[model samples]
Target: FFFSAFHCRGIRDDIEEEDEQVSDAINVSGAAPPKLCTSFAHFGFDEQLMHQIRKSEYTQPTPIQCQGVPIALSGRDMIGIAKTGSGKTAAFIWPMLVHIMDQKELEPGEGPIAVIVCPTRELCQQIHAECKRFGKAYSLRSVAVYGGGSMWEQAKALQEGAEIVVCTPGRLIDHVKKKATSLQRVTYLVFDEADRMFDMGFEYQVRSIASHVRPDRQTLLFSATFRKKIERLARDILVDPIRVVQGDIGEANEDVTQVVEILLSGSDKWAWLTRRLVEFTSAGSVLIFVTKKANSDELAANLTQEGYSLGLLHGDMDQSERNKVISDFKKKNLPILVATDVAARGLDIPSIRTVVNYDVARDIDTHTHRIGRTGRAGEKGVAYTLLTHKDTTFAGDLVRNLEGANQAVSKELMDLAMQNPWFRKSRFKGGKGKRLNIGGGGLGYKERPGLGAESSVSYQTLFLENCIISSIFLKSERKTCMMLSHCRIVASAAVCLQPVALKVTANQPPELWGIACLH
Candidate 1:
């Protein structure tokens, strides 16, 4: 599945080639009609707004924008499932802006007409910026509300009559609780990254905010994955909606090349990571994901010490610090971002070329989430995993699960690993130790060094002698023994034998051989 971007460079090239071919055809056939450029003058958009679109170099509407804009302009609920970085922000923002500008003639006491809630502060800011850019034609006011910034500043912005507010769930809920902003007059609501927000357990906050909006208002839900839970939430909030899925929801970025490298127990995983970083330094930006916050911090610090520009982000950091780290990474001042799962989700860095999992994820879900940081918006990217002995089992399980889900790891990556010198020398071998077969007749018998001819001994006496010898060995090894009345002995030895298995007659008197023999 693919999501095509209208103004993408690749798409522009294709259009250019088509235009050349069309001109050639027209020259050959004098009967061909000349192409005409239609203006948006008759669409009722403000003259200045149309001018701004032209100034922004937008010639025609993208497929998503063309389809979504009209519906949103009509104040209809929409569910848009498109590939990440498909200009989805503009698809929803343009119409919303047009509608708000159309309603700007309302009295001075009017409330906000639109509210866009994103899962992360970065995305919220991105949407906020887009809205400001598209709404430049009118005196439209917009403010971004997120936890990392000052609440007082946001309140002030709201009080000043910001017509549109793009915000994160937590910060938006705070504003609602403080009564600093009223959504009762809101006519448009957008839930961007609805699936991610639910996964982050922001359901209650989202519901509370949704409760404040007018019941009859238009609601738009957008996400990469519109699974059952997102559908359920949409059912609870949206009216009869126009559902748009541009591509397969489960389809990952095809341009991304993924590889898993299994390592020996004593190998330095950090060294392998540093080498990959060096290799990727010439390839735009890189985002490295680690499982723990402490690991992220330590790894970032170590990378910095090694003369690589890197930033760190985790849950333990305050909002201000997190914002700074993200800002630095986005500005390319920091080429690498070592982050935990919390900091990685919902981030909108478009130029990231590589995503490295410093450690194999404990589960398949986490593995998928981590690699998703790269190869966004149809850009070619790469994902790498560093696996230690302890991670082998989990990595194998994750790969198998992904295959079962029809997201197979690329065989090209496996071939690449086979050619790598490091992989050749340190690759993981098969399971250790040979399987022992106990099916032979002499399986339970330990052969003595020499056979001794002794006086006649009863069968029960011989069994008791053997039991005593086994009990002594077990006592020395800190194991347990269970006796069977059928003259069979079940003795468990440490480091070799399986757990004791015994069957005793109900009438048999069990003898207590030694205290140490009982586990």
Candidate 2:
């Protein structure tokens, strides 16, 4: 199974037959949940290791870590389902360190004891850095190997006896094929962002790499979304793993405020983006997502010409350029970077305060992943997406997703949705007559009623100077009748054949004080 740009899809439809086809859930009991983690002391971590964790500013264990760390330490396989940026990396990292450090030092030609596989080079680097910190405390060396990196440097690092190896599937397969590195002693295996790996069509390579590892190794799979497809992959790899499910699957980050702007035309998209950069974003780093690799560079060039500081990250660039752009982004020097879907999956940039979908993603999953780039590590973020007529196919899903995330959907966007047949059929009923948009702009009425000439009344009010009338048949020089606002009705039976304007009286009728006015 391989992914191609033409299809813009994930894995092949055919699910490869597995050696064992057990698809049922397997539960393992480990440490109970703690409402809050005061310190790492209660998790059975060494005093030296605890110092590193504390120095890293992880004062308390996040929910995933609180339960996941203990289970991983128990030497049980784990399938952790948590939202992105929920500290899942640290969850497996902490316990994997404990296991690796307990083992004796590796010989000069020996293999790594722990192997962590991620979908992209950026993620591999991130996980590798974390492992290095904890491993360094106990003199356990770790190395990161991924495609686009120097093969010689990676092979030499492996030869030096790294206790832990964090790498992507394709690069790992290359090293294994060349006998540059071996997974013979790998006791702890982690698949971070497992769904993304499968999405990129790395199943064959992942399984091929797995063949080199010991069968008794403890495997762990962590995914932001626990979809049925992800579950199938988990069944294939894990052995009766402990299932730790927390948070809504594929839900947008709570700290992110999502927005969808339906444009009248494609040309308006750039104008909207420029306006947003100048007005929508205020103080934080911004990430702009484009639909294609070319758009990334084009948008970056245009924005840069406009005096905004930005860089580009896409698959078309050489690994060196991508790394430099990522480095610049991390350093906050290039606060705004235009990127393609290649930058979507788990690239952590904690200071990103906003994400702009210069081109709205093709699917809701893609949109969620793009928006996830911001609001990472519990920081607040806002995402602005520009939508056009071409993306009508996804309008229904986009609206529901925004509403599901508790974000406001614009009335104009909903009005545009009525034209979409899918939205009209499936989403019309429950959503009808519900217009929450108040002052931003909109007539505010949910439905538009057609009126014939005889049934219609024209409103012509020049002034209301101390004059009160529940029912008014005002006659101007040109217009004949006046209609009440919000469908207020008139009780008078007689029609005003000859309309007359009312004059203001200084004093209100005494009886009016007791009666509430309707008009």
The Cα local distance difference test for each model comes to 0.60, 0.66
Find the candidate with the highest TM-score and give its number.
2
lDDT per residue (tens digit) for residues 1-519 in model 2: 954744432111111111011111111222221111213543656578778888898867666665576556555567786666778899888777777655556777978888999999888888888888877778778899999999999998988888899999999888888889887778788988877787799988877776667665678988766555676676666654566654445556667888778788978988888877866436778888888977777888888899998888888788889889999988988878888888898788888888888887866667778888887777788888888877776766677666656678788777776678867776645552223211011111111122111211112212132233223222121111121112211111111111111211113342332322563
lDDT of 1 by residue, 399-494 (tens): 433343335555533444445443434345421111111011111111122322221211111112223112211221122232211112211101
Highest lDDT against the true fold, candidate = 2
Q: TM-score for all predictions?
A: 0.65, 0.74
**Residue 47 lDDT (model 2):** 73
Deviation in Å, model 2, residue 150 alpha carbon:
1.1
Clashing pairs in 2: none
